[model samples]
Each structure stands twice: as structure tokens, then as C-alpha cells.
Target: MTKAELVFIPFPGIGHLVSTVDVAKLLVDRDERLSITFLIMKAGVDSKVDRFIDSVSAACKCIRFIDLPKDEHDPNQPILLSFIESQKPHVKEEVSKLVSHSELSHDSPRLAGIVVDMFCTSMIDVAKEFGVPSYLFFTSGAAFLGLEFYIQALHDEQKVDPTEFKDSDAELVMPWLTNPLPAKLLPSFLLHKEWMPVFLGQTRRFRETKGIIVNTFEELESHAVSSFFKGNTPPVYPVGPILNLNRDGDHNPRSDRSNKYKDIIQWLDDQPQSSVVYLCFGSAGSFDMDQVKEIACALEQSGHRFLWSLRQPPPRDKMEPPTDYVNFQEVLPEGFLDRTIEIGKVIGWAPQVDVLAHPSVGGFVSHCGWNSILESIWFGVPVAAWPLHGDEQFNAFQIIIELELGVEIKMDYRKELFF
Candidate 1:
């Protein structure tokens, strides 16, 4: 049989890359005829991503990783968007080389398609040049993708900007959702006029792809997934809960940060089953000192067995890897840690999935990132959501208000999402 191949261009983030690789693993495992090549974009500031690539390479012979040369970033456009756009030429170059190689090798697979991450829609041009079908891999749930489509159509139908109502307290009756979603609750990108066009533009390009493969299933988002089937849109494939479950093999290998959270896990081993409340925001999720103090106070007052994954706020002026607070005492209320020492343990950047999966973990007070939400559901740990940013607010809305699966700490991302 002739070989078949698919090229993957995941967004420049570890989570997106991991999920994309997971999809590739599923594909190759199901059909031995197929092999996938990942055109890895240089994104992260550290070696964490590189280490993941190395580990995955060792584990999967069917997958290939080609790191593209670092392109000069465009300062005028949005950072992530600009970075992705700059890689177009590099991606095209790599794909061309692949075509050349395949042409020379009798056994090499014929290029079947290209899979572009949702944010990397710009790379569709490369697929068009190669005469290959381009499928969009959406890392978030179908509900959020539906919201993007809804917002785009909503703006197009009225020929009005949704940001016009940014100041008012208004709700939108969206087709994908069972109830009206508050305008205030839409992702912050849609609320601001500056970012509105950028995100809406990306959403518009989604329709241009051959199909969209969402990291979700119909059962998880029946309404939203159904909406995709209603329109004359591209085919939708809900092949998800696509996650990297091999925590033991994760490149971190529990080498760098494992020591940090081992004590917390040991403490959890002593706790009763379903007795500890686990509070952790996603990797990018963090709070200001005021929010931290309020959380400590609440945990102190409740006297519940808790394991809090406390983190420090990011640099005010720049985006970088997560910065867990230097000292919990500096951020927490004075003496709060000592008083609650018996009942709780606050650790920096807890192994979130591990913590959530623990039998002792009864509940998750989460930032409601789509991934965090999925992990919580997967573990059968209930969630009290406080959406931090981006599509998180929308995710929180979907689970809490639409699906009735979770409760809300607050609907406002601007305010404290504390207990």
C-alpha cells in the first residue's frame, strides 16, 4: 500500500502542541497507513517545549518534529498572531522540502492533508500552495468555537460591532447555548474594539478550512456541536478529550518541579478520600496579592482540608513563563499559613492534573480554562469556577450557566473569583 501523510502546524504553545501530537498519536495508532509530521514553531522562552519534543520523538516513531528557524517577530501586530504569520514562509519552505523528499523516495508517504491549529489559520495558505486539504484543530471546546462563529455571524447580520455594547450590561441569545450569555461575559478580546477585529477575523477564517477537528465530543457539548451540523459550514469532527495523560513521561519528568509538589502529594495520601478541596488556576492563571490574601482568609475561615496551587502575578509589562510567588507568607495574610498549616498546604504550581486526579481531591476551585474544566470533569471532581481570562470566562459560562454542571464563584473576570 502507498504511504499517506499529514502535516501538522500547531499553535505556538505547549498545550496546543501536546494536544495536536495526541491527535496524531490517535490517528497513527488507528491507521498504520498514515504518518504525521509536526512543523514545530519556536514559541516558548524555555527548554520545556524542546524537552517534550525529544521525549515524544523517542516514544513515537510515526511522528516527526521539524523545528523551523526563528523568524523575526512583527512588532506591529498582536504578538502571537504576528509570530504565527511570520512562520508562513518557513512552513512553506519545510513543506516544499518534504514534497521534494517524498518525490525522490518510492516508499515515502504521499501528503494527504495539513492540520493547522485554530490560531494558526494563517498557515492555510501553505496548504493551498501545496494543493492539500487543510483541517483546523481547535484546542478549546466546540462551545467556544460555536461562540466565535455566533459572534462573527451576529456582527455580520447586524453589521454592528458587538463592542458597541461593551459598556452596558447585556446578554446575547446564542444558538449554541441553552441560555442567553451575558455580553460582559464574552471573552475580553471581543469586548475591546482593538482586539475585536483581530479575533473575529480569525473566526471568519475558520470557515475557509476544509473541516474543523475540535478537542471535544458531541456528548460534552451537544448544543454547540449540533449547531455546526445545522449550517452550510465545513464538516466538524469532535474527536476529543484529546489530552496528554502520560504525566510520568512528561518531559519535566518530575525532575525540575516534581520535588516542589511531592510533599503536597504525600500530604494528600494521608487525607481521607474525597476530603480535600484543590484550588488551582491553569498554568497561566494567577492572582494579585489582594486576591491571594482574600483566598487565604476564606480558606482559613472555612477550615476545610485544602491544597492550594498559589501563584504570583505575571510581570505587569510582559508575558513570560508562570512566576509562582517567592514566598507564600509575603502574599498570604500574616500568620494565615501557620494557622491553616494543619488543614491545608499551599504549594507553587501544583501538578494540576495529578492533584485533580487524586482520590482525596473532592473539589476543584479552578480558573475555568477549557483544559482545567475538562480535567475536572474527567476526574469526576466538581468545579467552582472563576474564569481568569481569554475564553475562560466563556468556558465558565458554558459549564455553570448553560450545562448546569458547575457553580460560579463570580461571573466577572475583572473582579475577584474567590470563595
Candidate 2:
């Protein structure tokens, strides 16, 4: 009997790619009879993405990575929407070509299906062309998906104008949702027409997929999940928290690149068991100079030992962090390093999973990305959610308000502090 072949196409973002990689790892581990191929966009192959691919490939023998050419327009540039629109055709073509070639090999396992990120809806047609089932992977929770679907229905009913909803002080209540959701709590991106088009377009494509996989547990969001599938017969799998499945592996990787911040691990080792806090806002979240200073002050006052990952803001011309800001600690609050020498550690970047898993680490101050939220929960660590932007607000809402897993921090004009 031939093994089943599956191709995973993840959205070109850190959180989405990470969650998708976890699912891919899980699929291959459950059954050796499955072979997996990961289709990565050319634009998504950055240093971080490459590192992740290497880590997963090392652990899973049945997994492979296939890179496609990035769109001609830079993915990091300001005109992101234009780039995605222009790149859609190429993405479809490349994926179809790969599937066709894979089918030609006599020894190849039959193509079982394609698993696509919710954002990568362009691949649905290609899956149809190849006569294979395609599944939509919503890298977020069921609540957010329910919100998007409701918004789409409202738009179709002509009850709401996407542009007017941006400023209208109306609170949207969707009784159909399993949980009580307010329009105000919907993803902030939906407020604008430009962003609405992207999401709504994706949602339109999502309805066409054969099935949907949400990265959550049935026990965690049963109400929302139940409401989501009430009428829709498509298969829904709540096969998570996926991060819990890989807790046994040793994640440390040795490299010549000495993490200029090795003191973090040493500090963590010194702390009392479950006494220290780990603070990280992910790679994309940023704060202005004033906000940075305020946060530094708050961490100093918190009186608990901490490991704070700070990144300097990008230069005016470039999207990448300024070269000089690479040494992040020097710019911190005056005497910040000297004052907290025994209790606090500052690193530009640390192996997040390893840090979170450490025996002494008890709490996380996070940007509330779904992957980070699930990881914290998987490790049984409480969180101090401080979502800065994007779907983080939604993720934080679910974890802090809905699940009662953590505390939410309010940002005041004076400083960034946790209560």
C-alpha cells in the first residue's frame, strides 16, 4: 500500500508558518504511511523561516520543503496588497505545476490533499484542477473565524458597508455565534476597506474548501466551534493544542553565532523555581522610543526577575531594524542594566520555546500571537497578555477574557505596566 501524500501551503508570516509547521510535524508523526511536502513562497524564505524549516526537517523524515520564486515586487515593501494581488496568479501556477509533476512519478504516493493557510486561498482552484481535496487551516481560534464569517454575511446582506463600519460607533452583535461577540472586538484589520477586501476575499475562497481545520481543542472552545459547524457539514477538526505534542524533543541548536545574550539562560538558571517572568513581543511588534522607555521603567518596577526581548525600531527608509540597534540593551533605561544585574536579564533574542519550558519560568508577557498563546498554555504557564496589534488583540481576548488563562495589561499614556 502506498503512503498518502499531503502538501501544506502556509501563509507568509511568522505565526502562521510556525503553526502550520506544527501541524505538518503532527501529521507525519501520527502515521508513517503519510508523506508531506511543504510549499514555501519565495518571499517567505527568510533567515528565520529557513531556520524553522531546518528544525522541522531534522525531526521528520517524511517532510520536504519546496521553494517557489517570490513575486517581483518586494514582499516587505509598503504596497503589500498590490504585491499579493499580482502574485496570486504565479502562486496558483507554481502550485499546480508542482502537483502535476509530483503525480507523474510512478513511485510517488497518491496525492491525498492540500492543506492551505486560511490566507492562502488562491490554492483552492489548483486543488480542484488536480482533483484533490483541499483543507483550510485557520491558524487562529474558532471565535475569530466565526467573526469573519458573520461579517461576510452582513456584507452580503447589504446591512453593513465595509467602509462605514470603520468609523460607525455601532456595536455588532452576532447572535448566531456560539459566544457573544461584539463588532468592536472583531479583528481591527476589518475596520478598513483595504484590509477588509483581503480578508473577505479569503473568506469567500475558504467556503469552497473541502474541510476546515482550526488550531484549537474541542474542550477549549466548544461553544464557538459548535456554533461554527451548526449548519455547515464540512469536517472540522479541533486537533490542538498542537504545541503540546512536541514537548519531549531537545530544541537547542548549536551554531557559531553566539547569541550575544547568553546571560539570559544563566539568569533563568539562577531564579527560584516558577518565580521569574519571560517577556517577549515577537519579531514584528514594536514600540516608539517613548513607549520603549516606559516599558523599561515598568519592568524595573515590577520587582520580579525578568527576561525581556527588545528590538530597536527600523530606520526611516528600511523595514529591517537599524544596524546600530542590534545591541538593544545599551539604549534601555539609564542604569537599567546595573540596577537589575541580579534579578533581570535583557537579550535581543532568545530561544523562546526553550525559555518558556525552563523550570524557573512561570509567567509570560506576550504579544498574544496564537502560537505563543498555545505554547504558553501547553507548558501550563500563566500569561500577562499585552497585545500590541493585529490578530494579537483577538488572541489575547480569547485567552485572557474567554479562557481565563491570563491577565490583560492596560497601556496608559504614562507607561507600559502590568497590573
Candidate 3:
């Protein structure tokens, strides 16, 4: 049988890489003749992403992994785009080697396509170099993807900048959504002109792809998924709820108290059913002291059984994962831990899927991350979205304001941290 090969260029972040790996797994599993090679790129000191290399490589024999050569990132350029562009040459070289000299290659190469991450559209040129099609892998839900299509068309094709109207209290009645989306709830990238160019450039390239593979399903987002059929957008495949249910293969961000995985589970086992509120923002989700104090105060006063996964913010401008707090006293409000000690548990680096799957977890207070939202839905836990950045605010709107699957603590709260 002839072999069909696919090259995956996922954003180096752990969250993006996880979903990208899931897609690779699905493709290879569904086809006997297909094989995928993940061209892993280096990020600034993430041991978790390294674990993905180890875990994913071991779990699936059909899938292959290749580490792209490291290069100096341009400091002036934007972080995500900058790192992706710098690896263009490495990607090109690796693809050349794969097509020409790999053991899997036959007399006639059947190179299929390149699958680039949502943020790594800069790799399209590399895909075009090989005369192969390029597909985009979107990690978010279908509703947010539709929003991007509308906003991009509004700005580029229609010649109206959406950022200019962000200050106003306007609601947009979009076809995909039943309710109006507050202009304030639009993505932070849309609200800021400086950030507009990067996202706009990406959405512009969305038109360039052979197709888009978004992580969602029709039953959950029928309106949003159906709208794509009527638009001038790329073919969108809503293959989602792509979760790593296997605990042995699950990828976690932090390494500290690795023992806490079992400990937390045991603790939850003792709690009353559906009584605990699980507050785990995305891996990079964290806050400053003032915001931490406010969260502590709320949790303390509410007196509900809670599990908060708190990580210290990465140092300013650094691209590393958030570290475990050395001292909870300095960070938490005075007497906050003691007062809430009986009702709650504070730990570092949660095994999100496992925690969400626990019966004790009643509701999730999340960063409104697409993956986390899917997990919440899968486990039948309602979300209380408190988005930090990226497409989260828009995702917050979809779940709370649009579908009403959950409530919102705040929609417009953008994180103050630069990283």
C-alpha cells in the first residue's frame, strides 16, 4: 500500500500542541495508509511540551515526531508569529528530507499536506514550497471561528475597522449566534489596533488554506457550524471534544508535587457529590496580587467547597510556564487560607480532565479556553467564565451570552500581564 504523509506544525504552547496531537492521532487511526510527522518547535523552557514529545511518541506507533532546529527569535517581532517564522527554513529542510529520503517513502512519494496551527499561518510559505496543500488546525469552538470570519470580512473585505467601535456599548446580531454579541466582548486582538495586524494577517490567510479543522461538533454549535456552509470560507471540519481521557497519556503543565494528582483525587473522593467548585484557569492563566486577593476574598466569603489551581505568574515578558507559589501567604489575603481551609483546597498544577471528571466538581470557573469549555460540557459541569486572553472573551460570550450554558464573572477582563 502507498503511504500518505502529513506534516504538522503546531504552535509550541502546550494547549495548542495537545489538540494538534489529538488531530494527528485521529487522522492516522481512521486510515490504515496514513502517517503523520509532527515537526515540534522549541519554546522558552516548557517541560510540559517536552512531556508531550515523550507521551505522544510512546502512545502511538503510527505517528512520528521530528524536532525542528532552533533559531534566534526576533525580539522586536510578536512572540507567537516571530517564533513560527524563524523556523521556516528548518521546516522546509525537514520536509525536503522526509519526502526524499525517509524509510517510509516509496518509489513515488504520496506527500499529502501540511497542517499548521491556528497561530502558525506564517508556515504557509513553507507548505507552498513543497507544492502541497496546507490546512489550518483551530483549537477553539466553531462559534468563535465564525466570529473571526465576520470580523475579518468586516475589516478587510468591507473596509471597516472593528477596533474603532470597541469603546461603544454596541451589540452585533450575527447570523451564527441567536443573540447579540456585545462589541466589548470581542477578542482582545480585535479591540486593539496594534494586535489587529497579527490576527488580521492570520484570518486573511484563513482564506488561503485548503480547509480548516476546528475542535467542535454540530450538535453543540449547530448554528455556528451551519453558518460556515453558507459563507465564502474554507471547508471547516468540526471534529471535536478531542480530550485526552487516558490518564496515563495525559499531559500536565507543572512538575511540582506530582504526587498531588492522587492526593487531589483522594481529597475530592471524600467531598460531597457535586459540592465543589473547580477553579482552574488554563495552564498559563494567573493573576497579580490584587486580583488574587479578590478571588481569595470571594471564595472565603462564599464558603463553598472549592479547589483552586493557582500558579505564580511567569516573570514579565518571559515565555515560560507559570511556577508554583513558594509561599501562599505572600500571595493570598491574610487569614484567607486559614478561613477557607476547611471548605477548600489550594494546589498547584491540576490534572484538569481528571478533576473535571470527578463527581465532586459541581461547576468550573475557567479561563474560557476552548478545550476547557469542551471538557466542562463533556463532564456536565457548567462554566463560570472569567476569561484572561486570546479568543477567551469571545468564547466567554458564546457560552454565557449566546448559549447560556454558563454564567460569566466578567467578559471584558483582559489580563494585565504582558506574557
- Please report, in order, the local distance difference test score of every candidate based on alpha carbons: 0.81, 0.70, 0.84
TM-score of 3: 0.95
lDDT of 3 by residue, 1-419 (tens): 77788989988888888888888888989997888889988877787777767877887987888888877778897776677888988898899888786545454436789999988898989888889999999998888888887888888778988888677798887778988888888877777767777888898998899999999998999999999899899999999878876643433322342554777888899999999999988878888889899899999889899999998988777777787898889999888888887889988878998899899999999999998999899999999989988888888988887778999798888774333
Q: Model 2's lDDT to the true fold? A: 0.70
Per-residue lDDT for 149-252 in model 2, tens only?
A: 77787787766766575434565665334344434545656666556777777787878888889898878787777776675536677877866344222224
Off by over 4 Å in 2: 74-80, 85-103, 162-170, 175-179, 244-262, 315-325, 411-419
Task: Give the per-residue lDDT digits (tens) of candidate 1, residues 21-134.
Answer: 889999999989999999988754645567678778988999999988877667777777778888899999989988999999989898999999988888888999999999
All models, RMSD in angstroms: 2.9, 4.4, 2.3
Candidate 2, residue 105: how far the Cα is off, in Å? 3.6
| Order of the predicted models by TM-score, top scorer first | 3, 1, 2
Show how many residue pairs clash in every candidate, following the order shown: 0, 0, 0
Which residue pairs clash in candidate 3? none
Model 1 segments more than 4 A misplaced = 251-260, 415-419
In the predicted model 2, the residue pairs found to clash are none
lDDT of model 2, residue 37: 82
